[model samples]
Target: MCKAKNMIIENIDELTSRGNKKGRRIVLELVEETLNQVNYYNIVKEVTKLTNDILKIKDLELDLNGFKNVYVIGGGKNSSSMTRALEEVLDGRIAGGVVVEKEGYTTQTKHLLIVHGGHPIPSSDSVKAAEEVLRVLNKVGKDDLLLVCVSGGWTALTSKPPRGISLEDHIAMHRLLMNSGMTVEQMNIVRNHLSQLGRGKVPMFAKGATTIGLIAVDEVEGKPWGPTVPDSSKFSDAVRVLVDFDLLDKVPESIRKYLETAPPSEESPTPLDYMNNCLKVHNLVIADNIRLCESAQKIASKMGINAFVLSTSLRGEAKHVGAVVASIANEIANFNRPFRRPCLLIFGGETTVTIVGRSGEGGRNQELALSAAQYISEGSRIVIASIATDGTDGPTDIAGAIVDGTLVPRARRLGINVTQEQNEHNSSFVFKQTGDAVYARNTGTNLMDLILVYVE
Candidate 1:
């Protein structure tokens, strides 16, 4: 059984009145339960068990004892926990390997060398860590077995710029793309082309080895750029994304040139190329946002609430989505149209924020929650909580924010203009002043973001 931590809403009682405090408490309890189900330690244990059980089937079994070398390599927010689980399962049979994780999330490993890297943006440490991963891959022989563990933050944690591209170029390109409001898929399409290890490039270094990838998927569609799996995206697709994002001219000259000039044949290995190499690789998605949503649904049912999963692939501008959700909740509260009173609506997926101008500290989840606050009708007993599963929503320490119908009125009383904060991309500051932010130190897991709405 998964052990859950307490809900992290600091001013929980203050966010509501005596009339709806019970509803707020129930919502917080549901959130806490859902988060526990996606905890890294619990995920690792569950995936490890599932992997072992699947391997027990005769058709899926591999003789690890026959391999000359058995190694593990990959990185992300959950990489450290995944490595620890692998170490426990494989024991002394594993050879030394490398794994990278976000700073401050590293776990103690006996054989795997843990590298601390940056997230949201790649840094010099990310470059060094990628190089070390490549070195480990080079040592694998034809008969070796390589276990690759990939999770949410792998893109930035394992970032390695291609030759002639400096780390600054990579960072600038990433910042531009992030601020440009491109979807994660679009950004990764361009990113896979510029990096050394993305787009199935990791298997290219394995030569004649057999690679098995255990992935913790953050994206809703189970599309995570496939760092170890065969990549279906083409260089042309990458170029198209750059143009679509209007980043063709804004990005660094090196990045633009690299994407424009690089021939498809010369680009990183595609799905077809992986078949020709003497390497065999398998990619398995052991967890995703769907699983998180399912767990939430079950917990809500247990609480006797009519829980409905609105969408697992929710995506759009954060603030707009927040209002959309509020509109739905308003409809339900006004007429009980969508189910009935005392219901829960759940959604899981990532949202984007287009940084129009100078921005302040805030993440998509925080902004979304704040924006949703406005659309909720006054005196309507509805509460919304939006949170990043990784615990760190953006660059800030807070996971996300929670708001009720009374939030706007409270902010008005405090002379805080919610709309002005939303316009300035300063939702975090507004949330801080209102004591509406949900705080969680890195949960060491990422399955995109989770939004929960409770209508009373």
Candidate 2:
């Protein structure tokens, strides 16, 4: 049996040392195994190989002899890991390039310049990284090969607002999007129109070069999330999202006016670019949520626990999803309608938290965990856990949280009101008080979020 390449849970001993030991142990084992399966470096290394000067990644192969220079560039939470793997596989064949990673998520790379940038918000480093990538793209020739390593968080890591938009306005636009209840896809659509490096423009920059994208998908369908993939959204679609979310008036006036009156010439490259050979690109999904969910299910089955993947496309409010998961667990624990006890149920997708007024600290995963704790009954053998696979939940360092039936009572004993915390979106504090917060460094992969429920 192949062992897991990476184990990211830093506090597994602390987490399992107190909670219903056996159940936490099993759930964490699933976490470790599933995360190992999606390690960005491992996934890329497994699928990509260079033998006899020929590069093969998945079904695509390229003869390096035809290329004068090979470069790797892109940005995200997983950029450094992917770039490191490519550097290893390609060895000295790489001609040097630039890729940006969220600060503190970067790993060592030899030939590539790894620029640490800001995420969840853009900073000067983000602009600097964008400029560096553009510099590299400008150097590419028709015989050059460009490897675009993309993953979640790439938008913020390589943000470059348009000509008329200020960095302050760009930041404001993101702030509004975060609180607008819009999904990541919707936000990316709007961002695609405003940012210089977004909306499938990276490949366009290296138009005559052979561009191959190594993407770590956070969405269920694994659609385009950054520069390498063709953006299917239009300027009108971006305008529609802003209007529907009622963020038109709330966002910067420049952003509003740009999206509202942006001409067709400013639109992103469509599928026509590929059909006409104007953009030569190949995108490969190196890792995704479904594969992570399936790995959990497979691991559970091997452990003699019945497992079912509820959904890979879970969305909507974080707290509401928590309630739904708790309700389902209640059904199984009480009467086993949809599933039996001693079963492992899994869900994978990104959930949103629509911030209103002054919000407290927490991410969607933490809020979901806190909300699920409300429905858990005393002495019920249920362990519900949610985690953002990228390892950071919101602006906090916590990956997510785990809860059992006794969570509320335990929190009460410590003077932590679970309901109030959830209301204020202060889930990290609640989890901290209850000793249920999960911690891990960046797991070297971005596949949205994962929630697991183990009932007995």
Candidate 3:
């Protein structure tokens, strides 16, 4: 059972008062319930059926007696919780291992060495964690069974640059890719080429071990940077992404030269390579945004609101997507074209913010909610909210923001200009002043971002 914590909100009464208080409460409840459904404990119970001598994950089953040793290795935002569950299932049969987690998300574990690292940016600690992971991989024997936990934030949490690529250069390249507004897939394509453990490097090193990847699919499908799975990306794809972002010349010289000089044929290893190398690898997605969205839809139905799930794979610029969702809500309110009145629309996916100039204190979700506020007119019966599942949005303490039609007018009455703030990329500042920002301490899990729209 997952322990319950106080749902953090800066001014709870102030936010609930915007939309119908009862309606706002329903929304908050639905969000909280959906999060609980995908919590680590629930996910482990749902995906794996464990016994004293046999462990089954989906269609794959492992006999504990067949392996000489069992080790757990991988890293991400939810790795600590996942490891705890595995520890309970394995019951002390597992050998020593190492796993990296995002800072502040670590939990007490008995067997695994937990290391905290940075996110959205890789620190020296990330490199240290990666080294530890590599050492574990090297120590695995031919008869060993390796249980891998892959989840969101792995790209940044386990940063290990290839030889000749300095950490400084690697950090600069990562920052450039993030601000370039590239999709997660594109960013990871370029990242796979720069790191040693990325792009099937881990599986390649564990040439003789049987590996099973228990993945928590967050943003993208198939776990793009999965360390234990065979990477299907290519070096050409990395070059193309850099070119598309117009970052060919702007990125660090080391990165540019490495991709330029590296052989194009050195693509991610294929399944055939793994098979020929005498390795067995299985990957199972224990949870994802689709599950989260479906749970929200069910809760909305129980609350007597007509609910429609927009898309679990929503992508693109945050501000534009926000405006588009607001337009849809406007149409629903005016004509009831898509659905009737008293309806709830939900969307889930990761969005990008292309930082052209200096960026302000906000994340993609906050920016999206602030942008939606522009289209909402006074007395308009529409409310929109965007939140990150991990609780924090960007570097701000707030999870995200909730805005209604009256939000803009309220800001204007306070001598604040919403448009100017949006232009300055200062949505967090605006939300702070207006008491619209949603606050929650680190939720210990991440499945990208969620957007909720209510039209009545």
Error of 3 at 296 (Å): 0.7
Query: What C-alpha lDDT values do all the predictions have?
Result: 0.81, 0.86, 0.81
Models 1 onward score TM values of 0.93, 0.97, 0.95
Collision pairs in model 1: none
Better of 1 and 2 by lDDT: 2
- The per-prediction tally of clashing pairs is 0, 0, 0
Residue-by-residue lDDT tens digits, candidate 3, 78-116 = 788788878887888888788898877775677789987
Of 2 and 3, the candidate ranking higher by TM-score: 2
Pick by lDDT: which candidate is best? 2
Model 1: per-residue lDDT, tens digit, 1-456? 223444444445554343357676777677777877777666666655325323321124676656888898868886787788777777677787998989866767778899977788999988888888989988987898888888877888878888778899999998988898888888888887887888688888887788888888886566644678777777788889988877789989988888878766757787678767756877777678998899999999987889999899999999899989999999999999867987999999999999987788899999999999999867999989998887788888888888887788878888999899898899988888877777775465678999999998
Residues 1-456 of candidate 2 have per-residue lDDT tens digits of 223344588877778877577788788778877887888889889999999998999999999999999988968997788899999999888897997989878878886888877789888888998899899999998889999998888888889988888999999888889877788988888888888888678877885899998888876555755688777789889988988998888899999898888788788887786667676789887788888899889988888889999999999999999999999999999998798778999999988999887688899999998899899897889998898888899889999988887789988999987788889999988888778899986688888999999998
Clashes in model 3: which pairs?
A: none
Model 2 RMSD in Å is: 1.9
Worst 10 residues of 1 by lDDT: 50-59
